[model samples]
Target: MAPVTAVTEATRSWDPYERGCPSRDLLDRIGDKWSILVLGELAQHGTARFTQLRKRLEGVSEKMLTQTLRALERDGLVLRTVHAEVPVRVEYELTALGQTLREPLKVLTQWSMRHTTDVLAARERFDGRAGAV
Candidate 1:
C-alpha cells in the first residue's frame, strides 16, 4: 500500500473531495440539521437569545443548541455577545462571513421546502421496495 502524505494548510489546495481535506469537517458541521437551522434562524431574525433560538428551533435540545452555537462562534460564522446587566444577557448573531452564507442557505431552505413532498414520496417508495425485498 502507498503511504499517504499530509499536505500543509498553506500549500494544500482545498478540495472537499480530497480524503484529508479540512473542508470535509466544515461541510459536515454546516450540513448538520441543527447547524443549518441555527444559521437560518439567526440570518432571518438578527440577534437572538439562547432561549429564543431554542424555542424557534423545535426538537433541538439545550445541549445541542449550546454546542452548535459554540461551534459557529468558533468558526467565525457567528458572534457571541455578553452584556452586563442585572441578570446579564447573552445573544448570538451572525458575523460578516456568516452573512455571506445567507443567500446560499436561503436557497437551500427554499429547495428543501419545495421538494419536501417529492422527497417524502421517494422515501416511501424506496422503503416499500426495501420491505418487499
Candidate 2:
C-alpha cells in the first residue's frame, strides 16, 4: 500500500529530485513507464476488464499490471468495479483524479513520439551498432 500523505497541492518542496518526499512517491506511482501506459489505456477505453487491459498494453506481464492497478486503486486514482455473478468479473476505470493525469501523460506521449527515432539514431551512433538492446 502507498503511504498516506499529509501534504497536498503544489509547493516549492514538491520537486521529484529531492529524496524521500510525497512528490517522489507520486512520480513513482504515476510517472513510471508501466503506470503511464496503464493510465493511457484506461483513459482511451474508459472501462476495461483485466484481460482487456492486458491485451491493450502490449508487453506487460500479469504481475506488473496487477501491481499497477492495485497501487492506483489504493491511491484513489483508479476505480475497481467487481460484478458478482456466476463468474465474477472485474473492470478498471480512471477516477476524476486519474483523469487529471491524462494531460501530463499525453505530453509524455508526445515527447516520446517526437523523439523516438532521433533517440534510436543517437543510440545506434553511440553503440556503432543497430538494435543493441
Scored by TM-score, the top model is 1
1-133 per-residue lDDT for model 2 (tens digits): 9997776565345667877767789877887788899899898789999999998889999999999999999988899999997699999999999999988888989999999999998987988755565
Which segments of candidate 2 are over 4 A away from where they belong?
1-13, 129-133
The TM-score values for the models, in the order shown, are 0.90, 0.82
Instruction: State each candidate's clash count.
Output: 0, 0
Question: 46 in model 1: Cα distance from truth in Å?
Answer: 0.4
- Give the lDDT of residue 87 in candidate 2: 92
User: Under the 3 Å rule for N, CA and C atoms, how many clashes does model 1 have?
Assistant: 0
**What C-alpha RMSD separates each model from the true structure?**
5.1, 6.9
Candidate 1 per-residue C-alpha lDDT over 3-109 given as tens digits, one digit per residue, 9 for 90 to 100: 99988877778989999888999999899999999999999999999999999999999999999999999999999999999799999999999999899999999
lDDT of 1 at 54: 92
